[model samples]
Target chain A: MTVSIKLARTVKDLLQMAQTEYFDAGHRTCQGCESAMVLRWVAKAAGPNTIVIGATGCMYVANTTYYTTAWALPWIHTQLSGTGSAVVGTAAALKALMEKGKLPNEKINVIGICGDLGCADAGGLSEVSNALTHTKYNFLILMYDNESSANTDIQETTMTPYGALTTFSQVVSR
Target chain B: MEVVGTGTDAVAYALMLADIDVTSAYPIRPYGGVMQTVARLIADGYLKAEYIVAAHEHDQFEIVKHASAVGARTFVGSSGVGWLLAIEAIVAISTDRYPVVALIGNRALDDPPGAYGVEHNDALMVRDVGWLLVWVDTAQEALDTTLIAYRVAEDPRVMLPVGISMDGAFLTHSEHVFKIPPKSKVQKFLPPYDLGNRKLHPSNVISVAPQVNEDWVTEIRKQMDEAMKNARKVIEEAYRDFAKIFGRDYGNPFVEPYMVEDADVVMVGMGTVSKPIKEAVRRLRAKGERVGFLRIRWFRPFPTDDIIRYLSGVKVVAVVDRDYSFGSPFDGGAVFTEIRSALYEAEHRPLMMNFIGGLGGREITYNDAINMFNMALDAARKGRVEQRVIWYGVRE
Candidate 1:
């Protein structure tokens, strides 16, 4: 869930050392958006041969705009209830092709990205748990707990703190 | 290849023969029989596969969908409320075109005053999900159709999941003689499930089910319909190959028409209800009545063309439905509404009568089928319709 950052000697050396970057730079995420940064690292680590399944949240809306996509690797944006199951399907299809010798036996990772509401409140956890416990294929589910449903204009959600003031929750001054 | 077994065992044997690699299941009445048989088969090493009992029916659907997505042939089952529970996944897998075979033990939905019995509502709930649905009448048909379902679903042209539905208690629990094809022949008939170039592989990373803009969303949706339309041909080809390999022909493989060529009144239905109706048609024909029956096989990608072609010559068409919609504008059965609309443009349309019966597992005997035929005959002779629907088998 957490990765440590290593300081490189210089930006030129860092760019030279990095051979592949999976997340494109032209996304429209809000300023200081940690979700987009985390996504960049995730896609970078997952490499080019990875399939990313994104749930309906800030990542989906911000990354996949009307005419453009910020995904350099193969990525799919699904509804809140679909990310987990869709990832499993992609992994299953990969396994089928690999076993049938239609596709080479290279290591392909299936990664699912969902928000706090998507994973914890939108009835999608069961789907993730089912895929994890049931399938032999390895799939990683990254729950971006942003403390609120941000795409809906930072509305208060189950993941929001008890006394947070937002569009759906307010403090009445005495 | 002939052996005495229940419908559950027939499906299990077919799953084994088809070489399913994973079976995700949760126990629900009538449908659980297939799970038990499959569990035992996997346990005894007869079927080499991963058999996982999921926490819930929804999980079961997702688990098998994942398994099928990963390139494993998969089998799953549900009945009644379990089907409702997994409806989201049901629609998801179909729209995504995952080729998983679901064995639906048709049972009444949990309406008020709930009871256990066979009803088509459970399977019919997601009728618009774009999956192919095959209604099997006998235990033998259950076995045969399961094999056919795999072929139909896996065809690259029609890569949608298929539902092989059988009436609970009537078919799942009842025993009948079923023929299992030889392993070699089945292998030949059903090649190993191949995704061809349409799979998730690291060698060629591809995105699926991606977000499409409004400009392209309609085309994505339209592709599902086109695939369903493509299924009509794939279904026929698979059934033809099935008949060739097994030597058991099911007439049209979409709709099985009986005694309709020279008949004036024709009855229509699917599943176990058709068995008794077939008998009723035989007896009515013997009694000098020009009567026939059409046992519909594929409900979705509904054999609309075959239904129209076969019923064109008939004078009266009785569509018997075991399920009803609470507030349909047609004020009749679900299938009856479809049948009525399908006949709107026909040059020679037959009089249509809707009979709602057999809800909550009530016995739909041969007498009831005969009664339906007589009603159709009366409507045909009178040349006009009165009551639109008869809730048969209900006591006043």
Candidate 2:
């Protein structure tokens, strides 16, 4: 039930971890994209029985592009401002339908991943707040603050206040 | 059972009858009424559902969209700018192909200091998007169509979302007597909501609607087009079965032609404008004038066959648009452009003209309808429309 939270402390434990590659290769991310690393570790930790909600950001635009996907697990894309709401709805639906004998009752990890621009600067803060208020729902929303709106040419975002400093620096250098 | 309630209340009853498993709400006038009633219904033990109150319309719509994907019958709605605010989720809902039923309390999407009144422009924005858009003129139709919307949208053939637009004050706020079918009869009429193999459950190991490039975009959009095309027949079936089980059939399933059988001129429009126009039709008929009214029900499907069938014999067609499309071809309204385009292929075409009025919920009086009809009749006799588009009630 708590597969995602299942910790691996020993080298033997890490080696014995599920060999299943949920987050497979062939993504279009830049070298040393730490967000991709987080997605990989989380996808592996959540295991196969997980529904990943990737908010519009670096991880989404990089992987799962046009008839292609690097993830073996079931994944769905959420609007930039819908990471929290999507996960809440998915988890709530799983519980409701399963209880109604519509879907099979089983423990499934619902993971929602969002970037800084999508979750914070793009008015998704309210969505995340509303999502957290639903205490009975079983889900997790991971807000990865990359400090800028990296998906759209790395524009300035809520996490990138120093983005204006770039302009100031340019002016001073001139 | 028959009960008197507002248009929004009628839709609330449909949510209960559909046995929606999840719904989301954020307070905006007109549309906010139904959520209040739905919450009351749940609190009073009349219905069982997950009622999520989000901080804004984005989360509100997103909640229901995703819920429908995971095999839950979901409901959500908004009005005016609230609907506009949820535009991102709204488009995603259609592309994701979840049969989520939404009640749009149609209002003007004006600037910051906007008025709360009936306007079709808010709903017209989705004309290009992949949503099954329909307009309900009465509270009774609102209730029944909301039920039918869920059925049509959830059908395997038409796995798309539906936007049921109700004219703000005239429909959403006005009270009218409507029949609420019992759960047993509704169960007979409508099947259970099922996504089958596409259900986003652990058991159904399928990913959906992932980001795609130019290589994959056309086919995905084409799939929606095919589904929308299939919806015509599926809608007819839903209406037939609804008549059999519920005994209330909206014949034609697209356009409601009132006294068009022997009329020389037909005034066309959607939503509550039909009320005043039908009254004008009767008044004109009494005066020995051959005039009729056609209420367009399904806007997304465009009801081309119904429009061509209903208006072909008529000499002239006058379209009263409650919403306008500035800088559009001939400066006509959205509905006007659609019908004109639909009529372009007809063997027998009527001299068509657009009359834009009733903007910002200004009342479309029967008198206004009378004036428009007279102008149309004059055009039919002249064999040409004197004016292509007229802002009917403008102070000019």
* Best-fitting candidate, scored by lDDT: 2
Where does model 2 exceed 4 Å of error? A1-4, A7-15, A30-32, A161-174
Clashing pairs in 2: A66-B212, A66-B213
Across residues A39-95, which tens digit of lDDT does each residue of candidate 1 receive?
Answer: 887776666667777888878877876567787776665557555665665566566
Residue B320 C-alpha lDDT in model 2: 90
Residue-level lDDT of model 2, residues B52-155, one tens digit each, is 88889989999998898888999999999899989989999999899999989989886744679888888888888899999998888998998899999999
Interface RMSD of each: 3.7, 1.1
Docking class of 2: medium
Residue pairs in collision within model 1: A91-B70, A92-B69, A92-B70, A92-B71, A93-B69, A93-B70, A96-B70, A96-B71
The window of 10 residues in a row where model 1 chain B has the poorest summed lDDT is B198-207
| Cα deviation of B151, candidate 2, in Å | 1.2
Q: What TM-score, over all chains together, does every model reach?
A: 0.90, 0.94
Error (Å) of candidate 1 at residue A26 is: 4.9
Q: What are the per-residue Cα lDDT tens digits for candidate 2 across A1-174? A: 133565689987688565657787868888887888888888878876799888888888888886578778888889988988999898888877877777778888999989987788678888888888898888888878877777777667777765354222344454
